[model samples]
Target: MSFPQLLTPEEKLAQGKTALGIRDVVVLCGSMRFAADMAEVAIQESVAGALVLKPDCNMKIAHPLWADPVEAEALKVRLDDQHKQKIRLADRVIVVGDYIGDSTRGEIAYARELGKPIRFTDPEVDPGEPGGDPAAEETAR
Candidate 1:
């Protein structure tokens, strides 16, 4: 008379295992050139782009540089510790490119060393253009 017997075999199996919940992703951007003043917009675009293609994903972001660094050691400590923590916690990372060199390179390398899924996506773009406008882009997140 209980619900357990009423449930199909598949439902019973599913009930025994933990639900595979929605995944969380964090993006590591290559360019901080525009991120300084427009951090919110820039980050939003990056995160949205990733989630747009991959719905049901949670997104976080990381800065390539530590702004509040008090000294050289402080800078390394903040960057190495905080940045790595976020990346390690992320389920996946999307590396954006205006034209990649160091920023993309470093982010990709770090994510790779951690054995996370890594992919590259286009920077936001205007309606018809190939890529996004450099000046007006906003960090929406």
Candidate 2:
């Protein structure tokens, strides 16, 4: 089953380097702590697949947590600046977070503030939509 279009992720990012002249994409996820790595991988893979499908663009994975930090304060500042830089530099930002509370809300808000589209993943729910019908006998048409 498919989700309501509006509820589905925003449309794909289109930036054909040869034609559209846009070259790079930077993806930022809410947290790459543990299992979240899979979601981040999926996010990168999708954009990479798009580039491969068209062969007109290049996508770069921007995992901010990998940034080096000399100290706690420096880490904070670096993260803050890197976040904004990704928004400014990339053609778009993809944020992958679970269906729980707004785990990616801050990223989404940041992207929105920069007028960028935000994408999400529902790990618990099926890919396209929710689970099987709970009321299976209501109207078995």
Candidate 3:
């Protein structure tokens, strides 16, 4: 009978490195308030050979001038759900912002629950970092 050979730790590490070289399907998550920033990050990731997915935060559709407050709130909920679905499909989530709002915070929590890797555009702005809250800094100004 032939035996199947198991891979050594070094062999497994090599395989992981090989896989890392392949393009990753990354989902960009952030508030619509920072849509432009999110788009910039998406473009940068795409240029780096990653398959990037971002929410369609086009101002034409989501602008408050067009929708009443009630309607706008409903739309925001729907859009947030869609973004969560995208995060479920992604290999990793990149949060693009200096200060994360409630929606982005929820997305980060969801991504953590799913055990996906999470990255931020500004490491200094992370909640755990010292002087991370821009609002505090602004108040001090």
Query: How accurate locally, in lDDT, is each candidate?
Result: 0.47, 0.43, 0.72
What would the per-residue lDDT of candidate 2 be over residues 62-95, giving only the tens digit for each residue? 3455344345446555655666655654555544
lDDT tens readout by residue for model 3, 55-118: 8865445565436877776776788889888887677888888888787788877877675677
Instruction: Pick the winner on TM-score between candidates 2 and 3.
Output: 3
Q: Give the C-alpha miss distance for residue 24 in model 2, angstroms.
A: 5.0
For model 1, how big is the CA root-mean-square deviation?
A: 12.6
**What would the per-residue lDDT of candidate 1 be over residues 30-74, giving only the tens digit for each residue?**
454534423453457466653212111112234444334355447
Point out the worst 10-residue segment of candidate 2 by lDDT.
51-60
In order, what is each prediction's RMSD in angstroms?
12.6, 13.0, 8.8
Weakest ten-residue segment in model 3 by summed lDDT: 132-141
Against the true structure, candidate 1 reaches a TM-score of 0.43
Over 4 Å off in model 3, which ranges? 1-23, 58-66, 128-141
Highest TM-score, which number?
Answer: 3
Better of 1 and 3 by lDDT: 3
**lDDT for model 2:** 0.43
Ranking by TM-score: 3, 2, 1
- Residue pairs in collision within model 3: none
